[model samples]
Target chain A: MIEPIVGRYVTIEVQGVTQRIYFEEAGQGRPILCLHTAGADTRQWRHLMNDSEVTKANRLIAFDMPWHSKSLPPEGFQTQEYLLTTETYIETVLGMVTALGLDRPVLAGCSMGGRIALQLAALHPDKFNGFIAIEASDFQPAWYDIDWFDRPDAHGGEMGAALVSANISPFAPEAERWNTLWMFMQSGPGVFRGDLSFYTRDDSLIARLGQIDTAKTPVHLIVGAYDLTCTPEDAKRTADAIPGATLSVMAEVGHFPMSEHPDGFRPFFIEALGKMPEPAA
Target chain B: MRSTLQTMQARLNASDHLKHLGRLFSETVLIEVDGDEFYLTFEKGAMVSLDAGPSRKTPSRFALRTDADALQKFWQSRPAPGFHDIFGLVKIGRGRIDGDMLLLVKNMRFFKEFMALGRVKAGADQ
Candidate 1:
């Protein structure tokens, strides 16, 4: 059977460079903008976008960042190395929001996306209806060496997939687990390291947590029970720091929750949506 | 432990799990659990040797070394967060790896499947 999702591209200028961003959308009503994890694409949200329960009353939108998937890199990309920073990341998301003319969309992201979600809550809470930061923490020390991710001798595809496979819960369906790994394996050269540059070395957001006014924009922090990278403990610390932030630890799920096991992730997602304050009438 | 490794070797050779992913993976790898060593040799994705070791004569592409407690936790059906993946073990300081990392990374899927056999064998023995 054919799915209801629609794919489209929008041209937006981010960091003084023009980029043609690819995004997929399904369903209708309040907008839910999704941001994929480091080195992954929009495919991570396929299951969520197809769920009738989610789409019937809400719209799900997922976009591939520049240099990832169908979204081609900006001009002069080949000459210089690709490195994502907080400034560039925020501009890209905001550029998309403005280009799409979204009305107070609920911003949701995983891992690197999750980190940016928290960053937005602290810096641009007024732009989103609510925030869902999955597998994120306020301050995560460098985990994997960047050299190991992209280098001359190591095969980027195999190394990236193998390193990430451990984050998948043993309970995740075998097919979905492999599917998640397959996408990681397909990432472009240096893309994984470029994205991780933001995740691992970004300035700490510890002090900024207090600035999030969850009353205006509810903050929901969800983490997988099996995410060794951003342990539930790390997310909890972030949640506690935010005055009204809510935290949920999903069992039998890992870093790639929506992709690795959407069935396990659906209930929690619906619940978070239920908590979203009704948009201004 | 010797018998367990033998059973693991037989299982790896019989399963089609690594069919497409292991064609070029021919290497000898070493595993050291709390100082007790086991040398495993894979020939074109099939286990050819499961040598229990004290001898330093056999060369390997790489070695994964961790304590017995860490191995026990990793072999659990539902391993703890930090022990679930080999990298996770290293990240949490419960494990160490040395030698040709590039070779190991290239044949990572093969090695991961090879290591996961411990979980299955441990469960079966229970």
Candidate 2:
């Protein structure tokens, strides 16, 4: 019988803000930050953290992003008044890394987290040993055009409510439904809408990606063949833009491939991490 | 009476697989509408209400309901050519369709047969 892998919460100070970051740390060797998708916390990477490959080769640090589960948003932060910019998110992540004294950790993110990973790599290439993004894409034009700040209660609007309800299904166990619903509700409407706006805004990181000094570090992109949220075409385009970036399309998977199809993705993830180029002398 | 009439009407609505429609009455069929929080069971041609809790019993056949408008369109074009083309538009989430997905590829006749029965529709295809 296999024992279940459990995670714990730790509080780390970012700048002046003391935020709680939930993480699952295991194994030894090179450090790697496993970032989760939007509306999801570190739990999404539970399978990866416990996988034999990760446990043997790298030290996995899975954490909840700010304004997400177990992590508190900065004080006086107004979701309706302030837009959640990708730059702000990257800065916070950098703060956490610096505060913890982590050595050039390899960065990995899924979906929205993936977008942040790309931004971090481009903005602060010196801080990371390598980067990996799953189902990440450039922001669509429609995202920035919408003004979610104008409506304070827009988070609880019909579409938001419907999405919330759909996420928790009757097929899931009662406990699972309760936990998932609680996270969605606690994340609140403004934060949710703000994040969506941040994601949809047209910020083409594609052109900026090639400028990253990948000669010293490696970059990888993993996508699902059936990812409805971000298609393989988008992943191909991103790969084409980034110099020497490798793209792997997993079979029979979707947006949350880490959870939906871990078995098929573990080997590829391990292979990519193993191939990370040695730091420039 | 009106509610019962509606239920009967919904059940009576002819599926392309009326020939094997009898199978629906004999075997248990689970219809999971992924988008909606609705999972229905049809046994002996009648709907059965199960407790809203987790159970060990899995369904024999699963049908995903994509949307109401697409369902209406398919219903209107009954006996229309190229019914299997509907699967192209329909999106399937994380559920198994009972019949052989390969047969649909290898033999177009079997494909048409499965689509004609309208036993299962992908959530996106509805």
Candidate 3:
């Protein structure tokens, strides 16, 4: 049987560079722009796209960040090192929204994506109707040395997969766990480290949390119980900082909630979506 | 601990994947469980020696130290969160690593698989 998800590409200008970004979407109605984690592709949203509960009334769209998966790096990428900064990341997401002509879509992101979602809430609250930040926080210190992820002596693929494997809960089905690892194994060389540049190096957004007008754009968070990197406490801290924000600490799951346990992640997402103000007709 | 280490060594050596993963790695690793020490020396991925004692003679490149209770929890087939992974143990203050962190991170995949052998043995024993 053919899958409901449809994949395509779009040409957009981001940070003064022309990029052909790859994206996948399923279903229709109010748009929900999904963002993937560091070094991961849009495939992380596959299960959500296929779920009837999510698709019946909402459109699910996910895009791979440049230098990740099918979203190839722009011209002259080889001339210098690839490092993700908040400015460039914000430009990319805004570029996608403009290129696709999404009308105030709800922004949903995980990890690095989740951080950006919060940033958007502060920087451009009216851009979307709501936000869903999964396994994200305002400030997170680097747990592992980024250099080890892309050294010549180590197999970057295996090392990346092994290090991040702990982010997934042991309770997840074996197949789902391995499937999630497969994406990390397939990640481009140095890409994981490059993505961590934004994740580990970014300044704390805690001071800026007060700027988020949640009354205009509601903020929702769902973190995993077993995630040591972005612990439930981290999500709570972010949630508590924002008035009218909702938070849920999921049990028996870890960092990659959507990929590692889609069945478990669905209810939280559905409830969050339900709470969001409906888009104008 | 001695018998379990023996079983783990045997299991690791028998796996071709582990052999390939560790082919370029060679180091002497110290494992300390509640002050009880066991030294495992590897040459090109094959475990050449497994010694049990508190010897100041053979120096180790790195060491993994955890209490017996934590080690037991980590070895379970369905280990609880914070015990399910080596890094998780470190994050939760249940385990500690000392010396040459780069060496351990360089061969992280191999080291993780090496430690996971205990899980296999534990499952079999059950």
Classified by CAPRI criteria, candidate 2 counts as incorrect
Per-residue lDDT of B22-58 in model 2, one digit per residue for the tens? Answer: 3324333333333432333444333454223133465
True contacts kept of 1: 0.56
C-alpha lDDT of residue A202 in model 3: 88
Return the lDDT, model 2, position A145.
Answer: 24
Error of 1 at A215 (Å): 1.6
Q: Estimate each model's TM-score.
A: 0.93, 0.62, 0.96
Model 2 TM? 0.62
What are the per-residue Cα lDDT tens digits for candidate 1 across A216-236? 999999999888878899999
- Candidate 2 lDDT, A91-136, residue by residue in tens: 6678767765778888988888888888887888889999998888
lDDT of 3 at B83: 90
| Candidates by DockQ, descending order | 3, 1, 2
Error of 3 at B124 (Å): 9.1
Per-residue error for A185 in candidate 3, Å, reads 1.8
Best prediction by lDDT = 3
Model 1 DockQ reads 0.56
Supply candidate 1's per-residue lDDT for B80. Answer: 73
Q: What is residue A95's positional error in candidate 1, in angstroms?
A: 0.3
Q: What's the CA error at residue B111 for candidate 1, in Å?
A: 0.9
